[model samples]
Target: MFFSKLSYTLGLCCLAAGTILQNGQVRTTNYPDIKIDVASYRFRTYDANATEISYKGRWDSKKVSWWSAPGLVFGFTGDTVAITFGDLTTDTTLVGYRIGGMDWSFTNVSAGATHLFVSSATPGVHETWPFNPLPFELRVTNWAYGVQIAQVHVAEGESLVRIPPHQRTIEFIGDSLSAGMYTSFEGLSSFAYGVGAGLGDTEYYVTAYPGICVSDQNCWGNPRGQAHQWFYTSDTSWRASTIWGDAPEPWDFERQETTPDIVVINLGTNDNNSANNVSTATYVDAYTKLIQGIHGKYPKAQVIVMQLWMGFYASGNSYAQNQGYEQELKDIVAYFNSDEYLSAPLVWDGATNTTTKLDAPSEPFVSYFSTRGIMQHNDIGPAWHPTDVGAIKVASHLSQFIKLTFGWELVATGPEIFHETLYWNDEQNY
Candidate 1:
């Protein structure tokens, strides 16, 4: 494998003034260096560590704590650091960086195993990007393919301190659109993260997988091929009726360090699969149950069920399927808006229907972007996925909805960025 010389820089060098805080210690650091165990609070998730060979040599005990899950975030208070990656055989392995929750950039693998230098540090200091060190979160949002980390390299005198978790958290649950599939933009989660950053301290969590559906049965034939599996592993293999909750086997919400203040559900793109052919009644019932389940888990959360975007659906002939998919979403939203409580107990099977229909207020809590025909593909990657510009447009509308609904301050939009094209190669196809 060879390294590609593809680099881009943004912003000027400046210093952000703030007192550092990490794990209840107010101690100051003058050493200019600190080694953080990946398992510490420095990393967002507490249970995503995986054993891997480190920058030192072998996979020793201490260094084996590298993060293995995609979107396993790590926050940094400093300006720059070197990230080490494991064996990458595909060009799809990517890392996304958001600075001060506004500026965004991505690093894709061009070499087998190597260290990538990322910084907003002042220029001329050891060949770093000359921007000031601001609060930043780096996420491997597209690691559905395999990618691993060994260690984070910082100056020998600086400390890798942990910033406290965001006060208000937003959770985005969906399919490829939410997974950052072909979008360089960080999907709805990043948009929410940016908006929440403006409103005191806020963070966002993502539970998205590519090609998954809410239909009880999909073309994949996995009985558990529903969108709720996000509460479980992104792994599409582990199927069971009782595999989600506050327990450690999959998604133990009680064990999760953060809970969302707002939850956004953007699905139905895959549910409209022409090959799978999910019935309208099946679609609506499955969607209703999913929303009810989310409400049951996070009662206080402001749940926003979104309309599905127009992707390149099933050889471009699934428009009717998509329309039906969208109507089911509207019916569910109307049902909830009409009553705070369900008229009947939610049935897991597609049998029960709630007799509540209310006009949806065209405001913050509701998203009608797809209905407005706003999410057109940027004509970049596969016709199926969105480009960076497209993702930004999606985020912009959602952010506006959040601002209007909660009266929260909104952050400025991030720079328009594009990820390298990803191709599935068997005979070298694009």
Candidate 2:
């Protein structure tokens, strides 16, 4: 099993440069002038503990489970780079990858097969400069199952290309939309990806689950406890205490040694569904408490209560019935940003002059912004989620909001709200 101790002959793989070939899609922007070279045929292995690899998100040793958990970041000069994962929970799941932080392309995690996270075989990668190792990230694209990364295989005699540090860490909390629902593409075309890529130096962390809510009751099929996103770590986190009769500790945000600088909450749409509906006061109260909890954990973090109104869901029954409640949610955000919260310390110890994460919390800046687009009936993908056009609009707006709010660098403008392509790529989705 010690692959680093063994040696083997290598082969020549198909070579490529980063320049766009047939389609107009960009590959590697850094390497414009391109040429092809024969890549190493064989592989050298690195264990999970390798120093060349940098990790983000909540990891337990070599394993990580959570919605779109930021897995591994590294660089390598290999035509065929693959990863081997040992099943942590016996169920097969998906893992993803991208080079230079483009959209993630994914591969299935079979029991023992070597999954090529990135390779020359891929379309865009087929044209990237192969002389030096290109930066790559490995990610968990789902919460259905956890994964234990056992080994990373790259071209012969190659170690990982070291990943650079990010300017700040941002955590996104929400359900379906933020969870990057993957009926076909496993979180490849998520708005979160566009945000991170647009933000330039952001360390992305997401804790989204499908059907999670802001109230105590389950949203039809959800299993997390009351105010689950704040009170617990995951959907089944309450199982130990309620079902197995064990006093399990909730998720420890301090365990990570730091909290996110910015936290975006994209919930509230699921508050009122066919099965359960909470009162406006109940939803607002729960949401306020969730904000307090986040402040307690990360006081200086700028919180964005994103009310995504784009796509078909906005004009549907939920919007008609829950518009008032959504307004209430928006009002709570205004209250946080007002002078009232500054006077009320019990609600949030925000006005304190503190620089570090300590008992005396720092004042957090909060804002609410809704998407600026009419519901394109045609652009909505399966399950009423936004297609790439809609998501890009959200990403463009949200990224600019974050950039301006934090006084960070400027972000490039992406597609407009009314983008050209309203057609859903049905062939790629289920």
- The top-ranked prediction according to lDDT is 2
**What TM value does model 1 have?**
0.60
Candidate 2 per-residue lDDT, tens place, 208-318, comes to: 655667665666455442354444443443222342233333566666524688888877666755345566677787677677767767767888887644234345444
Cα lDDT listed for each candidate: 0.45, 0.56
Q: Model 1, range 1-430, lDDT digits (tens) per residue?
A: 0001120001000001112222223325232222233333232211114221112101112222111113333444444555555443223444455544444454554223443344445333332233233334455533243344544555445544444554667776766566554333333233333333334445656565555677656433334444345445333422122222233133455545577778887767666766566777877877777766665556566788777655434445433212446666776777765634443323232222233332332122333334345554332234355555555566667777778876656543343223232345698655
RMSD of each: 13.9, 11.8
TM-score per model over all chains: 0.60, 0.70
Off by over 4 Å in 2: 1-44, 77-80, 89-92, 101-104, 116-133, 143-146, 182-186, 230-252, 255-258, 308-324, 344-364, 372-375, 410-430
